[model samples]
Target: MEQPAATYPVHGPSLRKRRMALGLTVQEAADKAGISRSYLQRLETGIRERMGPKRYTRLRTALNATNDQISPPPEIPTEER
Candidate 1:
């Protein structure tokens, strides 16, 4: 039997950058955005890829970030199995 390929979510560096730029701690940002600190951390670290529109909007508003900063990075193409 063949094994399935693994996939990773797009990395989001802008999230971390914006948060730091605003001088907000992970917990503070998460609280302001009504999300968990781990969730915020995963988003920043690319562990979690996609954020729903509501969550994205909340994070954007909390970070005072522009669309560019809140948006996910361009996905890299992966080779077919």
Candidate 2:
């Protein structure tokens, strides 16, 4: 039998939704993603908006999330030095 495609929650555009969908606590998800809990929390709460490729890949891999299920990291503005 073909397995059904995984569907992550779309209630909100934050990592928290995906974490909650999988019934994983922040610490658990962070550990799985190989990141600090505070970093993950920042991403979930929109305290931070951009993620580097390494971090993004880690989160996606940890969550087993499809491209659509995860929000792409928005481009960060260059500092006006």
Candidate 3:
């Protein structure tokens, strides 16, 4: 039998950015994601790194994030702008 590919943790900053881009406050996002506001805040601030599959799914759906959108973009140097 073939094995499935592995998945990784969602990036915190990307989650925050996505949530903000969608115009959701932490409370709203948490409510939509079925998690606590404090938990969502922890995820955004990097106090938490990983979420279980259920919570992850809820959060991803709430944020409208595809797999490719979960990771944060590289920080560009000021001089590069």
Candidate 4:
């Protein structure tokens, strides 16, 4: 049986907190992450969900967040197929 892929929900507040703690404005963080400011704002405000690893890595690096801090909520286990 094959298990389903893991999917974690984006933790918006934490992202915002980390960015602020680093004294980065939204534009600065977005530029560092190589994403648009609008998209970063959406992520910070919880308008977006389910960030893939590539984007997550960029954001994590930009915010200088540790693995634990950047980790999203764990995906619920599903029945194996």
Off by over 4 Å in 1: 1-11, 73-81
Model 3 scores a C-alpha lDDT of 0.83
Candidates in order, TM-scores: namely: 0.73, 0.69, 0.76, 0.73
Off by over 4 Å in 2: 1-12, 72-81
C-alpha displacement of 68 in model 2, angstroms? 1.7
Candidate 3 lDDT over residue span 1-81, tens digit each: 975334347678888899999999999999999999999998889888677777888889999899668755556878755
Clashes of each: 0, 0, 0, 0
The global Cα lDDT (0 to 1) of model 2 is 0.74
* Highest-lDDT candidate: 3
Give lDDT tens digits, candidate 4, residues 1-81.
Answer: 985345445678888888898999999999999989998888878888667677777888889887678556678999998
Stronger candidate by TM-score (1 vs 2)? 1
lDDT of 3 at 32: 98
List candidate 4 segments past 4 Å from native: 1-8, 72-81
